[model samples]
Target: MRSAVVAALALGLLGACSAGTEPQTGDPAQATAAETPTMLASAPVDLAAAEPPECLSDGIAYATVGQDAGATTVAWAGAGDRGVLFAPQENGDVCQWSAEVARLAGAGYLVATYDWGASGQAGFQAALDVLKATGADRVAFVGASAGGTLAAGLADDLSAVAVVALSPPAQYGDVDARVEANQFTGPLQVFSSTDDPQVPAADSALVVRNDKTSIVTEVSGTAHGIEFMAPDGYHAEHVRGTIDTALSQGFGEG
Candidate 1:
C-alpha cells in the first residue's frame, strides 16, 4: 500500500512538471507534502522529471548525484568559477533555499541544493562533486541547523572559501561541529535566535571558530535555521545583507 502511494505521488509530480505548473512558494516549514519530494526506499525516483521550483524556473537544471541506492536529487543554476552549495535543515528540502539560490545565481554565481535522503555526508559530497564537475573551482557552503553543523564540520576539509551556519547546534548526530569549526581557518558566520527553543544562542556559539574571521550573530526572536533567511523572517534584511557581504569577501568580490 505504501509503495503504491509513493508511486502515485511520483506520477502526480511528473504530471505537474509536464503541465508547466508553477511551484507554490513561501515558508518551507509551511510547504505542503506535494511541494516537497522525498526519497523512495527501493529505488531512486527521478526528481528531475518534475519541474524545477518556481524560483528555479529561469534557467535552473536538475540532476541526480551519485547512483543506485546512494543517488540524491539536486537542482542547480547559473555557471561560474565561484559557486554556493546549500545544505537544508534535517526536516527541510531543496525548496527551502529556492529564493536564495535564485538570487545568488542571478548574481552570476553557480548555486546548488539537494535532498539529503539517507546518505548524509556522502550525499552532500556527491552534490559538491556535481558543482565541481559543472565548473566551480571555488565554492562556499551555506546551511541551516543540522545542515549547518555538517557544513561547518566539512568546510575545512572541503577547502570551502566561506561557511554560513544558521542556528547550528554545537553537535549534531556524531558530528562535532565545534571541533570542526575550531579547525577551520576560513571565514565562518553563525546565526541564531536568542530564544530558540531547540538550541540556545550560547550553544550555537560553540560552533564559532576562535579565528578572527569567525563570528556569531544572535537575534531577538525564536526563529531557527533557515527561518533567519526566509523572505518574511524577522531579521531577513540584516541577515541577508551580512551574508552577502561575507560571501563577497570570501569569493574576493568585496
Candidate 2:
C-alpha cells in the first residue's frame, strides 16, 4: 500500500492546518494578481509565459500544453485511453491522485493528472498548464480537499468540464471565512461527514448552490480522508458517483 503520508506541507489550505495560517514547504513566497505579469487584466490567467515543466512525483508524467510559452503542464498517465483527471485532496502529494489514477485506469478511463503546482502559486500555475495541455475532448475536475480550492478557482477555466470535489472546505480562504455561495459557479456536489472535525459541514451548507441539487452525505463516525484512510471507504461511492456524473455531462455521455 502506498502510504499517503506526504510532507505535511503538501495539502490544501485547510486540510493540514487550522484557521488563518496555511502550511507551505520551502520559502513562503506570496504573489498577488497584480504581481503576475504574464496574466492579463482581461482573464484570471495570463497564458503568456509558462513555467518550465518538471515533475515532483515519481510514476506521474508531466507535460505542458504550449512549448513553455504560456500553458500549465498536465500530469497524466500515458497508458489509459479514458478521459478522466483526478486531483487528490490537499492531503499531500499526488498520493491520492496516484491511487485514483490507477483505479480509473483499471476501470477503463484514460486517466490524467495535472500537478497542483505543489510549491506555491507556481504549483497552482502548473495545474493550469495541465488543464490547457490536456487537449481533452471532454474533461472533469475531481478535486480532493485542498485540491478542491484550485478546482473552484479554476471553475471558469474548467467550464467545459464537470467538477467533482470531495470534502470541499467551506472556505478555501479561511476557517471562519464564510464563502458566499456566489464564490463558485457550481453544479458542485460536495462530500462531507458528520464526524468531520477538521472541516465542519455547516460551511459546505453555506456555499452549496440552490440551482442544482446539492447532495451532502453525512456519514456518521467518519472523518477527513475517509476513502484514502479507511476499510470500507464509504466515501468512495460518492467519489465515483460524482466523477461519473460529471463525465457523463462533460462529454455528453449517456
Candidate 3:
C-alpha cells in the first residue's frame, strides 16, 4: 500500500514536470518516502529509474557562515562530504534554490548556496572554508554565468575535483577570468547555448587547458545560468548527471 502511494506521487511529479508546475514538496520532516523527479535531459542513464534520494523525505539542515556587517552568508546542509558550492550569476539571489536544494541533499550531497558577500574570491573561499570546517574533504563547484567564471578561477587554488560552469564568459564584466581557466587542471565541464544573447557560445572557447579533460557542451538553445540546473528546464537531467559524475569522481561510490 505504501509503495502504491509513492508510485502515485512519482507519476504526479512527472505530470508536474510536463505541465511546467513546481513539484509539490511536503515538509521533509514529515515525509515518509523518497520522492524524486524523473530524468529530463541529463540524468545518469542507469539511475534514470532509481528512487529519488532520501533528502526528499528528510528536510534540509540550514546554517550560516560570515556575519561581518553586510557580509552574511547562508548555507544549506545535506548528508555527505561530496560538497557542491553553487555560485550565482550577476546579482542573483542566494535564496533561489529553496526547492531544488533539498533534492540534491536527498541524493547524499552536501550542497551550499550563498550570495557574493565580499569579493568574489573572498566570498567563495569563505563558503568553501565553512564546508571544510564541517569535515567535507572532496568538493565540487557549480557556478552560473559570472559565478561560473569565479568557480573556474578557483579550480586550481582550491584543488577541487570538478567544476561545472554554465555560460561563463572570458571576462566577467571587466575582470579577466581566462587566467583562472588557464591555471586549472582538473575535470571541467562548461555548458553554453548558441541562443544565449548575453553570452555567446564562443566565449567558452577562451577556456584553455594544458593537461586536463575539458568537456564543452554547446547546447542549441538559450538556457543560461541556473536555468540549466532547473529540473524542468532543457538540461535538467543533464545537470543531475553532471553533479553525480562529479561526486563519483571526487569520492568513490558507496
Candidate 4:
C-alpha cells in the first residue's frame, strides 16, 4: 500500500512537471518581423545567476515574519488545510530544507520552511502564525538538530498535530526536549544514527516520552541531523518515506 501511494505521488509530480510544457499553437512563420524581434528581446534570462535556484523553483513563495533582528524569512508552497513547518539546523537556513519542502508540497500539504532568527523560539512562533494566517489548521513540525530540539520542546505548546525530530539532543541550549517530550501526548517520532558523534542514538532516545504514540528509530551510520534527509544520505529513502507516512497518518490524510 505504501509503495502504491508513493508511485501515485510520483505520477502526480510528473504530471505537474509536464503540465507547463505543452506545445504552443502558434507558427513562427506567421509572425511579423517587428514582433519577432520584440519577442527575442523579451525572452526570460537565467534567474539562477541572481538568486538560489531552490528559492525560485518548485513554485515556492517567500514572505517575512516578525521584524528587525527577530525577523525570519519563510519560503512556502502548495495549499491545503494540512501543513508542515520545517525548522533548520543550527547555523543553517531554510535552503537546507528545500528538497523536503518541495516533496511535502507536492504531496498536497502546505509546506513552510524558515531559519531560526535572533528571537529564537519567538521567531518560530511567528512562522507558525504565518502558516495559520495562510489557512493551515492542522500542522506538523519537522526539524533537525537544534531545530529538532525546538520542535520537540514547542510541539505541545503550539498545538502541533505531530512532531518529527532528526538527530535531536536531549537538551539544546536553553530548551529541554526531554521534559517537553514527557509533556506532549501527541505522536512524536525521533530519528538518529547509532554512530552519530554529536548525539548518539541512546542520547536521542532520551527525548522519547515512552508514550504509546512516541517512537525512536536508530539507523546504523554516522550521519546526523539534516544529513538523514539528503537524497544520497544513508537510508535516506526509507527515512523520508517513514516520515511521509507518519505525517499523512498524523494529519488524518492517510
Prediction RMSDs, each to the true structure: 8.2, 14.0, 12.5, 12.6
TM-scores of all predicted structures: 0.77, 0.59, 0.68, 0.75
lDDT (Cα, tens digit) per residue for candidate 3, span 1-254: 33443453344323433111223355532322133322112211111122323332333322234445435344444544667777777676465554545555555566666656555555576667655644458888878888888777667778787787888887775455574535666677788888998888888656535244577788889888778877578787786677667556655552
Candidate 2 per-residue C-alpha lDDT over 1-254 given as tens digits, one digit per residue, 9 for 90 to 100: 01221211123111333111111233212211111011111222222222222222322333333334334444443222235556555535454465555444444344555544433224444544443333334555666666655454455454535566556675664322123534445456666667667766665455456455345555665466436234367556556666667666655665
Error of 1 at 198 (Å): 1.3
**Candidate 1: tens digits of C-alpha lDDT, residues 150-214:** 88888887889989899998888877888544567777889989899988999889888656779
- The alpha-carbon root-mean-square deviation between model 2 and the true structure, to one decimal in Å, is 14.0
Query: Candidate 2 — worst ten consecutive residues by lDDT sum?
Result: 31-40
Candidate 4 C-alpha lDDT tens digits along 1-254: 32332333234333322111111233322211110000011112110111223443334544455556666666555666787888888877778787776666655666777766675565567657656655579889988998888888888778888888999988887788885445777778899998999988988898887766788988887989999877667677777776777787687767
Candidate 1, RMSD to the unseen true structure:
8.2
Angstrom error at residue 239, model 3: 2.2
Q: Tell how far residue 97 is off in model 1, in angstroms.
A: 0.3
Flag the better candidate by lDDT, 2 or 4: 4
Clashes of 1: 0
- Model 2 bad stretches (over 4 Å): 1-74, 78-83, 106-110, 114-121, 174-186, 225-231
RMSD in Å for model 3: 12.5
TM-score leader: 1
lDDT of 4: 0.66
Each candidate structure's count of clashing pairs: 0, 14, 4, 0
